[model samples]
Target: METLSNLECFARAAATGSFSSAAKQLGLTPSAVSRNVAMLERNLAVRLFHRTTRKLTLTEAGERLADSIRSNLEGLQDAIAEASDQQQEPSGVLKVSMASVFGMDYVLPLLPGFLTAYPKIRIDWQLDNRHVDLVAEGYDAAIGRGSELTPGTISRTLARVRIVAVASPAYMKARRPPASPQDLAGLDLIDMRSTRTGRLVQWMLRDEHGNEAVSPVGERIIFDDPGGLCKAAALGLGAAFVATSHALPYLQRGELIQLLPDWSADGGPISIYYANRRYLPPKTRVFVDYVADAFRDQDLAGRF
Candidate 1:
């Protein structure tokens, strides 16, 4: 049991890359977390972390061992936790990840009510655009546009995100509004530059007539964040392609106008994602169900 506890401490530290963070999660002090990791290394006869003043990183052996043990250690912990608590109510810290813009626009609003409903569940939410390894990173769930996820990722569809072309009324007044998908070429288009690929995001649109238009690659204005591009368009910088979910407020307030309303590319479903666990933690289970219920209540599930 002591060895298992030490291994748990070591895995948490490796996942978070900080003794303080791991200690907080483990309900222990930083020194205790550090000592536990040291004890783990001593028992295994292998150095785990290459510790420095500025950062803590796993050594090669540490990386290999962490990879092997993170999921297994979590499973063991979950089984023990399930047996001890019997899961009468959702409790403990729940870690979740989502895209910043989406979470702010949609998920953030649901938090207050959820907290009121499940006071025992403490949420630790992370807004990040990059792909996350849920089990490896100790995240309970992730919400965002559902694409291909890692193996063992189970997803629930929350809503369908539709991509639309938008521009400020003042900006549209300067040029004839895009009568068709191809007319977008005439506008000063603000588009996103993909951080992962370092290239412009491709815009493919289709009209009700089934006529398709592909956005030009070398757009004049390129922004790294999608939200930034939308703001630029709202400021009359130019027309930008954005998720309708995020642009709804600006459109509703008459700050921006939707162009080619009948034409929108399917942006895919906004999904709630979690690992497929043999023993689902009560906190994680309730959070997923709560969000799904909220989406259904709002009629937002699979609807733009």
Candidate 2:
């Protein structure tokens, strides 16, 4: 019988198409990964991969075995997770991924309380704006903005985030505020490049009759970081459209003013997503519950 370690190495190498990448995924040295695959090949009396300096291609037999190994490993993982879920207190590293801004604004603040409540579990939180592959990256859970979730992931609505168009009071004093989404076209738009698609992001707004329209603005300053854009807007550089939560502090201090109250962009739902919901570790379950309860009363618009 092939050892589970050997099978894991072979499966990861085949899946990643590189021994080095597989090694990294498995937390093994590249040479160790190579040796494991070699052992598996010897045991099966077949070549598993055609390796060259730049790439690896799986053999026909290797491809077939890889599929079986992957399925079996996933099943075993699911079974182990199910067993672990039955424990009175979950104790394991819980990995979470989220956008940088949301993690900083909402999730990070709650960590101390969560850690104190559940002392057994450890946390590895990653914050990045780019989309993450939860399964491939080995994340246990993710909190993301927007409605669309990655396929095969379980999603729950954490909150509904509202977006608002805002400009510093100083900027509004120099230029008239945009009365409607359409008026945004003529303004000096401070564009967060990370959020902008192509030339601009469509500002979705609804009128009194519930008619919706998207207005694209001309970009005056394209900033990659949301914080930088917020700062620039606060300094009266240009008008900015940001999630209401992000602009809340500035609004309270009177550094920025909402441009158009009646017209605003709809941010879909702020959601907490996981690869699987059934048999979740107690720590993850408790944390999710805590976040849901914490934000329950506060309207999404007031969360920032």
Best by lDDT: 1
Query: For candidate 1, lDDT tens digit of each residue in 218-291?
Result: 37888877788778989999888888877888898999999989888877888889988776878888889988
Stretches of candidate 1 off by over 4 Å are 13-25, 44-72, 85-88, 127-130, 146-148, 209-211
Among all candidates shown, the one with the greatest TM-score: 2
lDDT of the structure predicted as candidate 1 = 0.83
* TM-score on alpha carbons, each prediction: 0.81, 0.85
lDDT of model 2, residue 302: 56
Q: What is the lDDT of residue 99 in candidate 2?
A: 80
lDDT of each: 0.83, 0.77
Q: How far is each candidate from the true structure, as Cα RMSD in Å?
A: 3.3, 2.9
- lDDT per residue as tens, model 2, 1-304: 8888898888878877888878877779999999999999998899989989998999899888887777677677667877867767866788888888778978888889878888898988888776676655657788877635555477888877677788888887867667668787777888866442434555677766787777566666877666776888999887888888788889889999888787676777878877664556677788777777777744443574
